[model samples]
Target chain A: MTSLYWAVADGWTITRRDLTHWVRQPTPIILGLLFPIMLVLMFGFLFGGAIAVPGGGDYREFLLPGMFVMTVAFGVEGTMIAVTTDAARGVTDRFRSMPMAQSAVVVGRNGADMLDSVLVLAAMIGCGLAVGWRWHGGPGATLAAVGLLLLLRFALLWVGIYLGLVVGGPETVAAVQILVWPIGFLSNVFVAPETMPAWLGTVAAWNPLSATVSATRELFGNPGWGGQSWIAQHATVMAVLWPLAIIAVFFPLSVRAFRRMSR
Target chain B: MSVVAEGLHKCYRDKSALDGFDLTVAEGRVCGLLGPNGAGKTTAVRILATLLRPDGGRAEVAGFDVTRHPAEVRRRIGLVGQHAAVDEVLSGRQNLVMFGRLYHLSSARARARADELLTQFGLADTGDKAVKQYSGGMRRRLDLAASMILAPKVLFLDEPTTGLDPRARNEVWAATRALVADGTTVLLTTQYLDEADQLADDISVIDNGQVVGNGTPDQLKTKIGGDRIDLVLHDADDLAAAAATVSRVTGADTDIDRDDRRLSAPVRNRVAALVEASRALDDAGIAVEDIVLRRPTLDEVFLTLTSAGTGHGPRETGRE
Candidate 1:
């Protein structure tokens, strides 16, 4: 616990450093939100009303949940890429040489990525609001929606962190980016998972991304799977379980990879 | 003792980085680790610093086994790595304070330490400048200062001046001297032979993942003998003739540096080898362009000894 204390503190310091770099550079920060915003502009208007939402009337209403999922996807890969860059730049090697904490590297990276995810969520919510997509469930529902979104982001964060450790260098980080597109598209973000063909729908519904969005629609009293879905009734557990499953499986693996790399 | 390693064997997969490497550095002595590239000099330093674990054997720093009590080891050790650990985004002052905070020092103590280091390193005026704006010399000073933030008993410096300009290198040498004066022991690795000469109380030459030679600089130099006879000839043909003539007169080994037309060889005694090479060169019609005998350097000693053994002899040990 004491070791973790110094490590986490160090990690937070590194986060502040990373943030300062972003603040000074400003390019990546602008680029971070541009893709999501561009998607909001492109898809929100073009596909509005043409695609059916999971729980309700407006296609933009359905699109809001999808955008939230996209935000997590868009943000988490950046964490992985930044880690690979650190490895290539010898920053990671430099840290290892210091008397600083080892676990702090991962913990700090995850913590910083979480901060970015929050900013991404805010931008996404603002965009959704601008596009006439409303969160009718008010304050409690908004908090619940964000809670669900954070849970999913936490899960994806571990996966990205692990992938970052697994990938040897920066060049391979792009290959990891390919997985995000498929995972994001397959979820209930844009359309109801049940509405898809039998096999993909089953996968889409079971996927943690879809689980969060499905549970999110239930909180907002948004349309989801014709009111008969199993996910709607057990929404709270699914939301918590997804992050737990991700943390359990990937967290240790990432830690193990981190340990292996220290050699 | 501030640092001790006994039979540490570290292997990276199929490659061994440290094999039965051993050393003990007393408090307040600057121990220099000298070796060429690919030698395990950095590896030994890392293990002693508790940054790496050996597959076999043990190491202790400040009376704590590095593997078992890493936090304790960390508490008593400061490391200035070969590269600067300062975050480029942070200003010079911020970088020092960040390290201070990381060491769990109080705000006041951290600030005081930062100020002292800034004054000592000559970085006081540039405190507000982002590290990226500082010159190479400034960065090296800050790196040394950052390592001293907590004033640990032992400091590890891996190649403290590999790329620094001569003036900047001297600045670092002065900083290290100050640390050693204050009773801080240091373990340093360097490819520059002069660096070891300038700072080390004891020298260890690591080659091919093992300790080839370890002793005081004079002790290591003695392995190549006290003196060497250098004879430079005008023509390439004279080199071969001179070698045969000198080998007959004195039984010392001979080598002619191909590019420089410099013929160098071991001698039983400087005076004896000089007399012999001269008489032989004159007798064999070898025009000796220049001839001089002087004390061999650690560089010559390292080349002649350490014996990578292309079928030379058994591994010699203990300053022989």
Candidate 2:
């Protein structure tokens, strides 16, 4: 019982350290919040005019829900950058050498990043409301949609931590940043996958980001591709399952990586 | 012993970082692990600090086995790595408080300890300034403050003053001395022989991942040779004559440098040898320009021990 208490206390202490960074240096957090807003405007105004929804529905509504999920997906880069910076700077070794609970470093990082994701989601939601996007579903479904987005963010957090532990330094994080774009665009977040070639569209439909995007579109009562595929029909179940599966795989990998840091 | 390691071994892929490494540091004493780059100095420190586990052998820190009871070891030990490990974005005071809190101090106590350490390390004036704005010396002092929050029984410093200017290096050395005065057992790894000569109670010379020599500074200097007398002649042609005179007076072999018109040889009695060599050189009409008798320095001891059979041969000292 005493050990468990210290674990939580130590984790919160590390989380507070990151929170202090937000207060001391707000520019990075402000820029991270602003990037998704810029993407929302660029897509909703520039590409929304020429694009057509699968059936008859507004593209802004379709784009807004996808933008929320995309915002959550992009959080991996921030987590990776923070983790790799700590490792390179020797801060991680200091933590490891301390008497604090062993699991607190990664756990605290996840907690702080999840909080960042929530703030980003809240800002994107406000941006959506300003640009004339509404949820026809009641408050309960909207809350579930937000939960699904966060669930995806939580799973990706482990992946970021694992990669950060494995990667050599911050220079490699830039390559990971560039790779995020291709994976982000390959999903159905920007457009209906049906508009692409058949093989490409199928691949996009199977992307984990697409699962959250499709499920959240249904929850928000927004326009979607309205495809007849089995995966689309089961978007909500896949959304929940995909992130759980990711957590199952990457969480252990992350813990193992942290433990093997001595090697 | 506050820290002990027996035949510690670590390998990185095909390369061996530490092989058959052994060390023991007693309580309340500073032991300097002196070695050049890639001699496994940092590797041995890491293993004892519980940051890395050796693939073979056993180690203990503060009476706890490093691998089996790392938690216990960590609770009693502190580590200051090669880089300043404190947070750059945070102020010096904030970094200390955060580390204090992680050491499980209560909020009020953490703050009080932070203030105390800031004052102690000479960082009280800059305590509120962001560490990024502080000088390199200030950052290193802050790093020391962070590690000392718990008044750890044993502290590990890995190359604490590698890049600092002479003054900053002195500041760090003073801080380390203060810690030792408080009964903290310190294991410091350094490449600078002067640092070891100044701070270490006992110096261990590591070469090729093992200790080549271990003794006090004076003892190690004596192990290589006793006091030596050096003479610089007025003319290059006098080098041969001076060498013969000095060797005969000192009863030792003389090394002659024709380029510098210098000759040096070891002596059993420093003053007697100096007096006899001056008279002998004067009688031989060697025209000696300068002569002095001095103890062999730790640099000479280090080169003589580490440079054996490495093919580079022993280089000249006083180059730096």
lDDT, each prediction: 0.78, 0.89
Please tell me which predicted candidate would have the highest DockQ against the true structure.
2
Docking quality of model 2: it rates as high
Candidate 1 to truth, TM: 0.89
* Residue A137 lDDT in candidate 2: 95
Q: What lDDT tens digits, residue by residue, belong to model 2 across residues A1-263? A: 39889889989898888899999999999999899999989999998899888896899999998888878878998899888888888999999999999888987898899999998899999999999999989999999999999999999998899889888586788888888887888888888888899999899999999999999999999998888889888999999999999999999998888888898
Worst 10 residues of 1 chain A by lDDT: A223-232
Interface RMSD of 2: 0.7
TM-score of 2: 0.94
Query: Chain A only: TM-score of every candidate?
Result: 0.92, 0.98
Candidate 1: residue pairs that collide: A54-A223, A54-A224, A55-A223, A55-A224, A56-A223
Residue B206 error, candidate 2, Å: 1.1
Give the range where candidate 2 chain B is weakest over 10 consecutive residues by summed lDDT.
B311-320
Tens digits of per-residue lDDT for model 1 on B1-320?
88888988889889988888888888888888877787788888878777677888899999999999887888888888777767777788888887787777777887888988898888899987888898877888898898888888898998888788998899889988988889898999988888898899998887876777778988877765566677888887667777778767666566767577777666666687788779878987888889998767777656655554333221222233
**Candidate 1: C-alpha RMSD after superposition:** 3.5
